[model samples]
Structures are given as structure tokens and as C-alpha cells.
Target: MQGGLEFKTEIELLSRVHHKNLVSLMGFCFEKGEQILVYEYVSNGSLKDSLSGKSGIRLDWMRRLRVALGAASGLAYLHEFANPPIIHRDIKSNNILLDESLNAKVSDFGLSKPIVDSEGSYVITQVKGTMGYMDPEYYMTHKLTEKSDVYSFGVLMLELLTARKPIEHGKYIVREVQETMDQTKDLYNLHEFLDPAIGLGTTLKGLQKFVDLAMWCVKESGSDRPMMVEVVKEIENIMELVGVNLDANSTSISASYEETSKGNSPYPGYPYS
Candidate 1:
């Protein structure tokens, strides 16, 4: 009975929300205690699969950045554009899916809750989210807000850069990245932390900017974090810096991803080690 209620809630939420970057609900089934949600088929599977090497497809630097932007756009829409403003309480890589062209689409809204502006800016409820991706403030105060999603997205950004799980071998990726940044003031040291498969040594400037944005999103205080709208703008700027013309057309971005992946080493003369 309780499971049925949760399913109804998710259906009610997803049915009313529509965006290019969010998974579209096709239909649902609720017969004989069997409940199911039919969503648009996303061929590329979850972002977690891509990062964990289970997808069999390599997400190069450009692809990763594009995925990040797409996810951010979806979240921005949910927080800013959606009626009543929805908060995706569970914003983790596993919930972010990709299509055949590798375009990201946020999915799994079972834990989502609508923000009642009248009650307050935040919804005080039981903290419900994945372990590694949950926001500290939300966990501590049980005050859920859009910023909690930002914090989880920050962890997602780190996963994209490092191609590592949020928690590997009992070590938190965010803490590790923060410690590394604290120790090394030079951006050149970024190569040491970034995923070697992307061959991102030449893209230091853009990567550095992305790191800065991620750090801001994961700040201890929700007030310190940038809004989702700001996050989208920053990602757009980063895409621009990387010469990705997202406005051109889908074909253009696809071609760019192909070309960027051709040369194994995006930076030939630059030192990778």
C-alpha cells in the first residue's frame, strides 16, 4: 500500500513536468499489485555506468562536459521553471540517463518533492538520498531545498572529471578533490587529479573553471552555493570556452564529439604525467 502511494506520487510529479533534458514519461501500469513506469528509452544507460566503465563507451572530455550541461539544464528547469518548483531529492549519477547520442536526461523522480513557497523556502522532511551524494546541510537539518540538488550535482561533476565513484575504497571523492585543491594552488597539478582517459592536459583553463564551479556548488552552506540558473550559465560558458557550439544543432555537437575523440591525446606536446 505504501509503495503504491509512492508510485502515484512519482507519476503525478513526472506527468506534469516536461523538459528536453528530463526523461519523458510514456505510460504506467498498476494492476494486481504490479506497478511500473514506462519512460522514453535511453540507449546509453546511466551516467554512473559510463563513468564506472560498464557502458563500454568512453565519455571523452567534450562528452562529459556536454552531459554535465544537459543535466544542469534539466535541474535548472525543475528548480526555476517548473510550477511550484520541484526539488529532485535524489540527484545522483545513477539517476542521470543518456540517449543514443549521449545527451543526458535526468530520471527517477520517486524521491522528488514540490517546494511549497507558502510554507517556506525549504521543505523540512526526512532526508532521503543516496549516501555519497546527499547534501550535508539537508542531512543535518532535514531542510531540503534546491541547493541540496546542487550539492549532489557537484559530486557528479567530480565523478565526470575523475571517472571514479563518489566513494571508492571508503574514501570520499569530494573530500579527496578538496584536499588536492588545497594542497596545490597551481592549475597544472590538475592533471594529477583528472581522469587520464580524457587526455585533458591541454584543456587546463576550462577544466580549472569547471573545478571552481563544482567547489562553489558543494560549499558547506546552502547560501554559499550558486543557484541552478547560475550553474547553467557557468556550464554554458565552459562549453563556449571549449569551442562547443550547442546552439548550432545536434549534428554539430555530435561531429565535435567525434572529432575530439579521434586524437587519443588532445594535448600532444603537453606533459600528461
Candidate 2:
């Protein structure tokens, strides 16, 4: 899978996908038994870095919501807008890249598979994806569906809110969050699990709704999970409910992150990493 046909598969899949929220493939090199893919530079770095506080980019509540919306939009495009529908077998926080403007772009399509000639039909294939992010149903049934991606994205959504890996300390984020969450209290009584950087002291508007939608996406049954398109719509509604003006916040956030990152950025400033 390293230097052979997986490279070609990635190229084919990436070439067919074009979206602002998706990492764009510029070109590739295949010569002298070498394989190289050149992608557009995303200055900010991976979402994992930021969530782990390695990027020095402090994402507030609105910023996190925007990131969720952007990533969901990209997945929706792949699932619903692409020429042939695509199921991104891997949808982890490590594969989500952030730009200087804090926009989210889905990356690493090496495991992506196209669903051909049928609507809402699944492919019987080997289940391939990161542990804890893989859909439980797909893992048992070996039937790859677009909803499988939804299950993984739901885990990523939880990671965004909690700043924890899908699996940490022998625990899964989905179950941990579900058990800890109490809708009767503020912030769903998830103070211990929610990341402090997302402004828990202050109000997080539409957070309960966001958490509900994310939990829906992570439902045990694929049939019970909402589609990526529905995820995008609900995220948009959350942003609207919070009154996050997309155009205005981009500039302000850049400035704030710049000051925070001044002479102390944890990222190496790699142009193509």
C-alpha cells in the first residue's frame, strides 16, 4: 500500500474531488521507482496538533464550530456532490488539516473508495480504518457504506470538543462522552471532559444542539446515523444560532492566533507538511 497502486488510487480519488474544504492535489511524481504527491500548503497544521496544544492556535467556541462545519462540508461534497459517491474510510482528526484562516480541509484519501452505479448501496469489502474510528457495524459486517464515514466523523466531532484522541487511556471518546454527558446541567454537565480552551467558563451557544447532532452521527447503527449532508446542515444551523459571522471572524481570529503564536508557535512552519 505504500509505493504501489495505493498511490494511483489516491491520485484518482483526489483528482475527482474539488472543494475548498478538501486538500487539493497539485501534481505527482512517478519515476525512478519513486512516488510523490504534492499538495497545497496549509499553514496552520493538522487539527491534532491544535487540539493537543502543539500548534499554539487557540480555537474558541465559534472557531471550533466553523472548523466542524468546514470539515463536514468537505465530506458532504465527497458523499453527495462528487461524480461517483465516495466513502472516506478514514476520517480522523489527524487527517484533518487547518489553514491559516482556521478553515478545515479533509486530507489523506489513500483509503477512499468510490461507490459506483448505485444510490445508497454498500460495497462488500474489507474493513479498513483506524481503530476506535471504524464503524462497529462495518467492522462486523465488512460492508462499507457512506454512513461508515459518518460514524468516524462523529468521533472526530467529539475529539474537537474534548481535545482527546478517539482512544486514550484505554477509553473511547464516544462512550466516555455519552456516559459523562448530562443534559440536565450546563454544558451538558461535561465540564470534566470538555476542553477548557473552548471557553467553558463562558457560555457556548448551541453547544447542546451540537453535541446532540454529533451523538446522532455516532449512533451504533448506520441506519440510525444522519448523513454527512445532514451533519453539514445542522452545523450550519448551530453556527447561525450562535451568530458567528463567517467573514468577520476569519480576520479577527487570524490576528488573535498571530498574537498567541508570536515567537512561540509549536508547529515547525512547514509549508507542505
Candidate 3:
């Protein structure tokens, strides 16, 4: 899936879009049936690595928030500002890379689609994406929309908090978080779910709001999800609440892409202002 048509598509799409939070395409080669795309070397590994403790980069709450903001800013630009607009069919933590500063850069555009170039609002096509991060609605009806990415991003948000894979040991993070969440208790009674490195029983400003927003994005239905632009605003507001500079940046717990898909899934208007 990373060569030929998909490879060229990735090259073309990356060539057209440029953003600080997006991995930059340096150059490429496609002669003699050989294909290569050279992108700016993002020093730090993927967000998945950091969260899994494989990258050895301790992610505190602020750094994690900044990483989330950077990824959201990149997606917002793709969904709103790209000339023809784009929908990243995959939005998992693995596709999010980090630079030396630990600022996130959205990578792996192999599955990106120009939402506006298609027939209209939503592009109807065979759904292709990572197992845990695929959108339930998209997987169901094959209608790829901006909100699909939102759903996947919601899962990524949960990954940030829990530092757990979307699905681990047959337990889906979305369902885990959904069942564990109890608004009546302190920290939503999510101490067990939260990554201890984020600190324990300490006053984590904006933690509740952050959890609420993540749940909102993962609503079972796409329409119930917030637009990427709206997500950016919410993150920015959360950052401000957490005392991070608003000037700087930027989940129901939908059923597993497995369970719902085994049973039962719009594009966006461009130039949202």
C-alpha cells in the first residue's frame, strides 16, 4: 500500500500542502519503477513511541498538550485551509511524529484524500485505515468525512492520557475509558487509566475538560463529533486553562472499530472561517 498509486498520491499531496506541524517532503524519485519520497527528518520518533516509553522521552502533561495542539493545528489546516481540502483517513498516534522540541508533526499521508476534489460533501469509497483508529461511520457506510478523522483523533487523545495502545490485550481503550469514567468522582475516577507520569492525585488543571472533549469527539455518530476547527478551539481553550499560552496552539468512546464494524459509518466545506 505504500508504493505505486498510493506512493504517487502521497508525493502529490505532500507537495501541495505545507505546514509547520506537517512532515515536509524534501524530494522524491520515481524512475525505473523505483519510488522514493524524502521527507524532513523528524528527530524524535512517533508519539506512539513516546507514549509507549520506547522513545525514552518523558511526556509530561504540558508536553503532551503541546503535542496534541500541534497535531490538531496540522489537521485543522488540512481540513480547512488546504486548497482542495484533505481528510487524513488515518489519525493515530503512530502517524504523529515529533521534532527535537517535541512539537508534533502529522505524518503518513498515504491515505489522505482531497475531500473537495471528490464528487461532493463525502467521498464514498472502500475504507482503508489502521485497525484501532479507523472511524466507525466510515467503516460502516464507506463515506469518508472530516469527522471520521475526528473520531480517530478522539482515540489518539485517549492514547495520550492512558499511554496505552488503542487496543491492548483485547481491551479497547475507548470502551475502557468510557466504562471507567465517573463524573461524580475526583479525576472522573480515571486514576487507574491515566498515565502515572502525568502525575498522581496531583491537581491536573483542565484534565476534566480535556476528557470531556475527547469523549465528545468519539461520539458513535459522525455528526455528533466536533469539526477539526472546533477541536482546535477547544484545545486552545484547554491550554489556556492549563496556563499554556493560547497564542501557541491548538471521544465518547465510540465502540471498537471492530465490534461496531463487525455489526454496522462527510466531507467538510472548505475554507472554514
How would you encode candidate 3's per-residue C-alpha lDDT over 7-110 as one tens digit per residue?
97798899989988899999998888878889999999899899889999999998888888889878878887786779989899989999999989999998
Identify the runs in model 1 with alpha carbons over 4 angstroms from their true place.
117-120, 182-188, 201-205, 248-273
lDDT of 3 at 168: 83
Per-prediction backbone clash count: 0, 0, 11
**After best superposition, candidate 2 residue 197: deviation in angstroms?**
0.6
Residues 150-263 of candidate 2 have per-residue lDDT tens digits of 989989888989999888888878877877889998889888889999998897999999899989997877888987877876787788789876565432332332343211
* Global lDDT of each candidate: 0.81, 0.83, 0.82
Name the 10 consecutive residues with the lowest summed lDDT in model 3.
256-265
TM-score of 2: 0.88
Better of 1 and 2 by TM-score: 2
